[model samples]
Target: MFDKIRDVILEYVELPKESITPDTRFLADMHMNSLDIMTMIGQLEDEYDITIETEDLNNIYTMQQLVDYIEERL
Candidate 1:
């Protein structure tokens, strides 16, 4: 699941796989904009077949958080 999430995130960002850890920040570290985050979220929703609430987006700020969110839904 982590690998899949990483892959999905990579598609929208230019970060190296090595630099992307559980603590990597989507906005601060990756320098992602709102569009990138939204696109990543959309991809994650489709990939996991889950719905991510708009409010929940703010709570997910790291790779681990995103993975945990998906795991919880699954």
Candidate 2:
């Protein structure tokens, strides 16, 4: 799942796959703005067939957190 999520993120950002870790911060480390995040979320939803609530995004910061959130819904 982490690898799959990383692939989605790569579509929006130009970063080496090895650079993105579980602790990588989407905003601080990846330099993603709100729009980038939203776009990625859309892809994730389509890929996993799951809906992610906007309000729940408040608690997600790192890669692991996002993975966990998606896993929970699965």
Candidate 3:
């Protein structure tokens, strides 16, 4: 699941492989803004076939957080 989430994020951002570790901060470390996050959400929804809520998006900022959220849904 983690690998799949990473791949989905990569589809939108050109993040370095080393920078995508589980603890990497989506906004701080990855330099991602709100728009980047929304784009990422879209990719994730398409990949996972799940619609994500805006409120839920607000709570995920790290690779681990996103993985956990997706895992719960899966």
Error (Å) of candidate 3 at residue 24 is 0.4
- Range of the 10 consecutive residues with the lowest summed lDDT in candidate 1: 2-11
Candidate numbers sorted by lDDT from highest down: 2, 1, 3
Best lDDT among the predictions, by candidate number: 2
Model 3 global lDDT (CA atoms, 0 to 1)? 0.82
Tell me the lDDT of candidate 1: 0.88
Assess each prediction's global lDDT (C-alpha) against the native. 0.88, 0.97, 0.82
Indicate the residue-level lDDT of 70 in model 1.
86
TM-score for all models, in order of appearance: 0.94, 0.97, 0.85
Instruction: Kindly give the stretch of ten consecutive residues in candidate 3 with the minimal lDDT sum.
Output: 10-19
lDDT by residue (tens digit), candidate 2, 23-62: 9999999998899999899989999999999999999999
Q: Which candidate should be chosen as best, given TM-score against the real structure?
A: 2
lDDT of 2: 0.97
Question: What is the RMSD, in Å, between candidate 3 and the native fold over all Cα?
Answer: 1.4
Extract clashing residue pairs from model 1: none
The best-first sequence of candidates by TM-score reads 2, 1, 3
Residue 48 CA error for candidate 2 (Å)? 0.6
lDDT of 2 at 28: 97
Worst 10 residues of 2 by lDDT: 7-16
Positional deviation of residue 28's Cα in model 1 after best superposition, in angstroms: 0.7
